[model samples]
Target chain A: MMIDFSLYVITNRDLSRNKTIIEVVEEVIQGGATIIQIREKNLPTRIFFENAQTIGKITKKAGIPLIINDRLDIALAVDANGVHLGDEDLPLKYARKVAPHLIIGYSAGSICEARKAEEDGADYLGVGSVFSTKTKIDAGEAIGAKKLEEIKRAVSIPVVAIGGITLVNLPEVIQSGVDGVAVVSSIIGAESPFQATKKFRFTIDYLRKGKIC
Target chain B: MMIDFSLYVITNRDLSRNKTIIEVVEEVIQGGATIIQIREKNLPTRIFFENAQTIGKITKKAGIPLIINDRLDIALAVDANGVHLGDEDLPLKYARKVAPHLIIGYSAGSICEARKAEEDGADYLGVGSVFSTKTKIDAGEAIGAKKLEEIKRAVSIPVVAIGGITLVNLPEVIQSGVDGVAVVSSIIGAESPFQATKKFRFTIDYLRKGKIC
Candidate 1:
């Protein structure tokens, strides 16, 4: 299964406001989200599993991959397309051993972590808090495009820029040579998730074409 | 906060059947479950968080502590009483650093792991698949009461025996000096979760008196 790294939306319930996560996700998908990751840090296990199953069906129908954030059991339980692990979550090698068929993405804060993730058989890397992020208070200081570029060059696997990614700064992130961008508040917290997603999709595509030229 | 590890019920959604996880959990709590860990391995992040919040409320009102299995983020988000982590989940030391007030339990397969978990500030240790559990296919072989005893001896912290524990084997596990027993299928899978929990609680208390005598 080829996993698309473009326009990946990681869900945050706190950012979704009054809308349910499913509602936000569906809108984003309609607006051309290439991939969806359920990154909620607060839901209880059963609800999380049910949501994954629900979202998995939607993402499957849309022909886009759904990745469960942090929990491997949920990914396997929902038969999700993949799982995304943070630096503190399960190690990539062990996660790979347990779920060989699942696409695994690891959060990388530095070149060392990125290289190790690639060596450990991660399918892709979510590298950042590229700018200070409200989504995760302790995500650390912004790594900036310079370090993101360094990480991109250091690892063989695709790197997705995350944390504080927005339309205003996305062109520079794309210029930094990241394979994709992961958004949280900017999309899910928007007045219209669909419009926000569409704007991001357009910007990403435009930048990629410019890079190719 | 002092956590009562006695009658720790780790939930499995697959085993819960017709009732919701909250319904099953509430039933078990009423039947004398001391600690409740929402161990649904398949829930999506939002659902897991919401479930934890809901269950946390229930557990709190009853004065029974709630532990979220594996995800520290969810545990913190829901203000859960604690978190239970396997060898594959977050490291105990880091989890402690992040959530100093939360009660942390680590699953230990060996004496070394058990001791390390204690040193790393784990509130308790969950040892086994002591009877070969179908619940965790990869839980490996049953470590038996003998290893459970050895782990108990090796670790200064409280030990909770888990995996395939039932009314039949409850006496033997109790004899092994476990501070508590963590159950999945034996309770949640039973026809009446409340009755199953009552039976386990009664046996545990009876065994404790026997040990005291």
Candidate 2:
């Protein structure tokens, strides 16, 4: 599967301003989020599945790909576009073998892991703790944009930088040669997810093309 | 599928006196465990998948059902007989929809959960921390055999008593009318897993039929 996405938005209910995942997803899509990842670390399975199903409807209506985090079952259950996995989650090869059609995104902290993920048939790579953020507790020590560039060079698959990526540091992260940036708190935590997403979309495009379109 | 296992042995490498999971699985099977659940809470995905595959082979040779604890991907990847889920794991219905051929065991601490699992198509129920033991830290308060009886009555599917079950309490747990007992430390952490399994098998048989032969 060819993964073409920019300004990837990850959903974190705790970071949102009392907005349901559906509301935030709708807002972000209007703001130009090309991809959506439902990353629920603490929800029960039933609620998680329902949320994914509800969000899947919105993302589908907008023609945006829905990515489920750390759960192949939920991804398969809700028929999402892809499933994202970290080091502690299911390995990429197993997920590929089980669901060949779904785009599998692997989280890589180093170049070695990035190369392995590509070899293991991951459609894309999410490389991060890029700027030391608290959104994901186990995201590990901040690897910095320097490491992101190194990893992007090491893997052939599309690399999406994640963790602590805000407007201030997004330029540096974008300049790291990554294909995209996945934001959690920056968009979901903003006063207006729609406006936040529009700004992110503008910044990402501006940085990539060297002009404000 | 008809899950007819009496002695359900759960593998915990940490308590295995440095023995590998494969070693403990082989020992327990020889001693007469009818089913095996590969429960690796801390193992990375690759190693966990490898262990499940290796253990799957042993269980297949012996014609015993192999269940992966809390990971549906690993169970599906290695073609295990089932995947056991707890409150925090993937919900039973989603797993059933994805893998209908695989048995789905659900952990239910109360009758409400047990009845819900049955409605959701769980093949069996693991009702426990039947007694207070250190094997499963999250097994919660020891529900005792009395609660097991109540849960067993509330559901039609087979119920397996787990957590802190020992030979001394085996009669009470069995007398609670549970179909089987899933033991962790009692078997994996025993000095002689084979002998311990033999003892469990004999006791379960004797208690159920009131005869030695």
Candidate 3:
């Protein structure tokens, strides 16, 4: 399925200024985040599933799609809109088979991976570590905007740029032709996640419309 | 799906005497392990998926069921025979929905959980820590064979007893009316996994036939 999200805010509870994931997601929806990806790297499976259920309610009420990161089982259990898989996560083909109606997203750091993901039935591609950051220790070195542009051009599926994505670097990332941006620290780590997400939403809208923010 | 297996072996590479999981599985199969459940608690998701693929090939060639522990995604990705989920793992209802044809096993410690699992479409029940041991830190207190028999009577699905099950206690476990036994340290951590598995298999067979071994 083709995905239509623009500003995809990934949840990181540790960086959400002491708010629970549910609270962060509510604020994100209020700030106009088109979609929310629940990315808990260090939670027990049952807790994660419960959290997903709670967050699913908030997102559903706000008319926002909820995407679960790295856990298709949890995503399916909660009937979230989709699941996003990284290089080390579940393979796209099997995920597609397990949940044909659920949107499946694959992470791609190169044009080769991007094309393969699209061919393998990924609804969208999460590309990058476009700029280096401390959010994910294993996010690898930054790929920069040039590589992002090449990968974007290589696939027909939507490409979402991620990692170290802040307001300062978002314009160049948008110019790389990605369909959306997946942010962590820029939104979740901000003093006010709502304000930060609003700024991101406005900037992406301006950039997509070919106007300077 | 009705599961018909006697000796269910769970892989623990750490206790396999320096052998790779594949090698341990080979030995277990040689000793007549009716089914294998790949339980990699520490491997990365991609590596776990790869290991499942390798074990899947072995189980497929041997005409035995391969049950991936706690990872339905990897199980489906490799076309395993089933997936075994614990209390903290994926919910059985969603797993049943995800893979209707595959055997789904649920871990239940009480009669309420067992009946609920069967009602929720679990093909079989893995009931245990039948005896407490150091193998699984979170296995909880030993439920004893009395509890096992109670749980067994509570559900119509096949019950596979797990946790600290050794040949010495195997007879009592069988007398509790379980359909099979799931062993970790008793087989994998043995000096000869094949011999250990063989003895357990033979004992189980003899016990089932109502004969003293």
Candidate 4:
């Protein structure tokens, strides 16, 4: 399946505020989020699996890809379009060997990691906290646009910029030539996830059209 | 952490019949099942996480260990006492390196795999399908008691006999010097999970007392 990484929304139930993760996801997808990643870190296994299946159905029906974060078993259980894994999670080679059909996205913090992921057959790369942000307390130091650009140049696979990304600074991230922008609080945590998603989609389209930031 | 695998009950929700996995688990624990493995392969991620937390809490209060099947993320998320990995799951060495405190168990079908698991710092080995059973369609051929004995001799760590284990065959498995017995249908799928658990517990205790089968 060809995965569209543009305006990828990583779900954060804690940030959803008065809304279930599924509700926020529906709104975001309706507002033109190209991809959805179920990234809840603390939900019990059952809840996470249910949420993934619910969102996966929506994404599948809408022709959007649903990427499960960190849990390959859950991804397989839900028959998701793909899986998104971090450095601390299972290695890419093993994931590829086990689930060759799923599009595997690996988080890379450096040129070496990006190259390694590409060599290991990762379908895409998540590169960032291009800016310092609180969404991930342990996202390490911000890699900045220079490193993001370096990573993009170093790898053949598509790259999606993540971490602390918001509408205000997305232009700079887009300027780094990332294939997509992954957002958390700026969308799901917003007063209206639908509007926030629309704004992000508009900005990405405008920037990608070669408009000056 | 020392894991007591004496009467390990691997949850099979499909075989559970009319009861939730958590409900059957509670009854089994009350009937003296020592270790619990939440092995639901089809549950959504959210439901699995929730079940793990609920079961983890109950097991923690009862002083029993809960082992999550396959997904290390769920094990770490719920602070499970340990994790059980199949042949196709994450490599043992990497799992040990990442989660040093958890008691890791590996399933092995041969002496080489058994010895390798011990060398990789696995806390225990689950050697199985001692008698042909339909529970695991992909469990391959039955290894029988002879192979189980060889596996026990090959690995220094504790060994648990799994696959088609029931109260009727518990004696033969125990006589092979296995530290524990893992059950699926014979307990959870029984007409009364609680009563079945008690019977298996009694049989294990009786065999451990050096009585003839």
Question: TM-score of chain A for each candidate?
Answer: 0.95, 0.95, 0.95, 0.96
iRMS for model 2?
A: 3.1
A1-213, model 2: which lDDT tens digit per residue? 345578899998999998998899999999999999999875765678889999999988888899999778889888899999887777777788888888999888888888888999999989988988988833677999999999999888899998899999988898888999999998999999999999999999889996532
**Top-TM-score candidate index:** 3
Kindly report which residue stretches of model 2 are placed more than 4 angstroms away from their true locations once superposed. Answer: A1-4, A12-27, A40-54, A108-116, A127-157, A168-178, A188-194, A207-213, B1-3, B12-23, B40-47, B108-116, B128-157, B172-178, B189-191
Off by over 4 Å in 1: A211-213, B1-213
Q: B74 in model 2: Cα distance from truth in Å?
A: 2.3
Model 4: per-residue Cα lDDT over A1-213, one tens digit each: 667788999888888889999899899999999999888775555567777878888888989989888787678767788888776566677677667777999988889988998999999999877888788722467999888999999988999998888878888899988899999889989999999999999999998998774
List the candidate numbers ranked by lDDT, top first: 2, 3, 4, 1
lDDT of 3 by residue, A120-154 (tens): 99989888889998898235679999999998998
For candidate 2, list the clashing residue pairs, or say none. none
Error of 1 at B195 (Å): 28
Kindly list the per-residue Cα lDDT of model 1 for residues A148-192, writing each as its tens digit. 999999988899998899999988899998889998899999999
Tell me the lDDT of model 3 at B171. Answer: 91
Interface RMSD of each: 11.5, 3.1, 1.7, 11.1
Best by DockQ: 3
Residue A157 shift from truth in candidate 4, angstroms: 0.2
TM-score, predicted candidate 4 vs. hidden true structure: 0.58
- Using Cα atoms, each model's DockQ against the true complex is 0.04, 0.37, 0.63, 0.06
Residue-level lDDT for A84 in candidate 1: 89
Better of 1 and 3 by lDDT: 3
